[model samples]
Target: MATKMVGFVWAFLIIIGIIYALLSGNISAINDSILTNANKALELFLNILPIIVLWTGILKIAEGSGLLDKFSSLLKPGLSKLFPSVPKDNKALGYISSNIVANMLGLGSAATPAGLKAMQELQTINHKKDEASAAMITFLVLNTAGVTIIPTTILALRIAYNSSSPSIIIIPAILATASSSIAGLTLDYYIRKRNK
Candidate 1:
């Protein structure tokens, strides 16, 4: 369904763009636009790829050094409250904590592996494999909403663009993410309560 929706939107946009370009007698601009956007995408990828690689390497080191274990331990108490359905000794908690930490620091690429591991662990505990469990739903809500602290990717992009004050966005991003996290948690809690 989502794939279909995306395809529909893309087709609609392309059709509209072509029609507008022809009507404006700037059909040549359509080809130029495509080429320009393709170049911009490549330029953007080149700028962000290094940051992703560096952070992914750092995450690997953290895991190897047992830093992730310590970090997970620190987050365990609070995580238990948020994910009460998950067993206290569950391995998923560690991965969930690691995923959250990586996301906060804006290492989304690094977080993916841990998040996948977490989901796999969660599935083991799920009695109904067909439907999402409460814990899984809560975890997904928190993960998707994000509680970004560093916003490293955004900062990196800003730097690439030579922003006057790249770091200025840090506080705002933190506040915004915090708000989203709060709202998401609140809604999840309310939904769980109502369901029960």
Candidate 2:
């Protein structure tokens, strides 16, 4: 549904742009913009690809070295409290921990596989397959309001765009994400309590 909405929005914007360009007798500008922006998009993708690959490799190394397991264990106590429905020894918790850690470092592309695995594991324990379980909803909220510490992707984009001080956004990103995480968790807690 969200994908459809995004597609509709892009289509609407493109139609509006073309109509405005025609009305303004600047249709050629639209052609130039399409070509230039496509090149810029490709350049941006190339610039970010290395960073994503490096981080993904690092995450894989951490997992292979048992570092990720150690980190997941450390997070388990709190996670257990957050997701009481999930068994303490469940693989879902481990995947959830890994996903959160990856998001915290701003490695969203690397986090996707873990997140998907977490959801799959959660589904196995879900009694009502048609509806999202409480744990699933909570996880969704947490993931959406992820507390990012590094903001690596944004920093990479800033560097690619020639920003004078790419790291300047670090503090603000941390504070904002932390606030969002806190608010989301608080709201989820209340909703859960009310449901019970």
Candidate 3:
């Protein structure tokens, strides 16, 4: 369904672009827009890389210092309620903690591996071959709606575009993420309850 929607959107955009090109009697503007967007995207990527590397390194150091482990331990009781099938000492707990920590710091690239590891571990505990387990679904919801403290990617783009006070977006980012997280968790709980 999502793929179909994407296809429809792209097709509509192409058709609209063609109509605009014909009515405006200029295909050059389309080419110019494409080139400009591509250049802006490249600039944004370059600007973000340094921040990504720096944050990932910091997270690595924190991981080595056992800070992430401590954070995991602190959250373990609550997490256990969400993932009852997983043992307290399970590697998935570690991965989930690291992923959440990285995300909180707005280091998504750094978090990807840990998130994947957590998902894989969750899958291993799932007995059904074709369907995802309740824990897996809940984890997915938590991740999708996870709160971001810094919103590093957006801040990088804003800085690249010469925005003043890029850090000001942090409050809004927190609010948006908090709302989504609450909604996603609520829906997940409702669905799981219904399933039972």
Candidate 4:
């Protein structure tokens, strides 16, 4: 439903823009913009494609080499505390750890499969199928406020755009994401405690 609404909004805005451009006798400008932006978008996508592919390959290698499992093991204790309802041996925890690790490295696209798998695994244990479980809500909060230590996509974009200091965003992104994660977890904790 939200996706449909967003699609409708984009369509409405595009229609409005076309009508305004026609009335203002700036249809030529609109045409030029469409072509220019399309080219630029394609250029940007091509530039970022290699970086995404490289990171995704590395992620796969980590998984195959058991590095991801080792990382997940390190995260399990803290994850168990956060999601007490989930059984310690549940596969959801493993997927959640992989998703979090991928996100931390700024590979959101790479993390998506693990995130989806985690949600599915979480759902299997949900007592109330119609309503989201508290663990699910907490996971949502954590994913939304994901603490990215490295903003790989943004760095790639900066590099593509010829930024002289692409890595300069590293510290600020870490600080912002860490703060948001802390705030979100704190709020979630209090809300759950109050509900109990």
lDDT of 4 at 65: 96
**Which residue pairs does candidate 1 place in steric collision?**
none
Per-model root-mean-square deviation over C-alphas: 2.5, 2.2, 3.2, 2.1
Lowest summed lDDT over 10 consecutive residues: which window, candidate 3? 68-77
Residues 118-138, model 3: lDDT tens digits: 989888888996788888888
Residue-wise C-alpha lDDT for candidate 1, range 57-105, written one tens digit per residue: 8778887998867876798799999998899999999899988877876
**Residue 128 alpha-carbon offset, candidate 3, angstroms:** 1.0
Q: Give all candidates' CA lDDT scores.
A: 0.86, 0.87, 0.82, 0.88
Index of the highest-lDDT prediction? 4
TM-score leader: 4
In candidate 4, stretches whose alpha carbon ends up further than 4 angstroms from where it belongs are 1-6, 19-26
User: Candidate 1: worst 10 consecutive residues by lDDT?
Assistant: 147-156
TM agreement with the true structure for every prediction: 0.84, 0.87, 0.81, 0.88
Candidate 1 residue spans exceeding 4 A from truth: 1-12, 23-26, 53-61
RMSD of 2: 2.2
Comparing 3 with 4 on lDDT, the higher-scoring candidate is: 4
Collision pairs in model 2: none
Residue 20 in model 4: shift from native, Å? 4.5
Flag regions of model 2 displaced more than 4 Å: 1-5, 24-26
lDDT digits (tens) for residues 1-196 of candidate 4: 9799999999998999999999999999999988798889888898888887887787788879988779868998999999988999999998998889888777787688999999999999999899988999899888889988766677789998899999998888789888999999999999999988
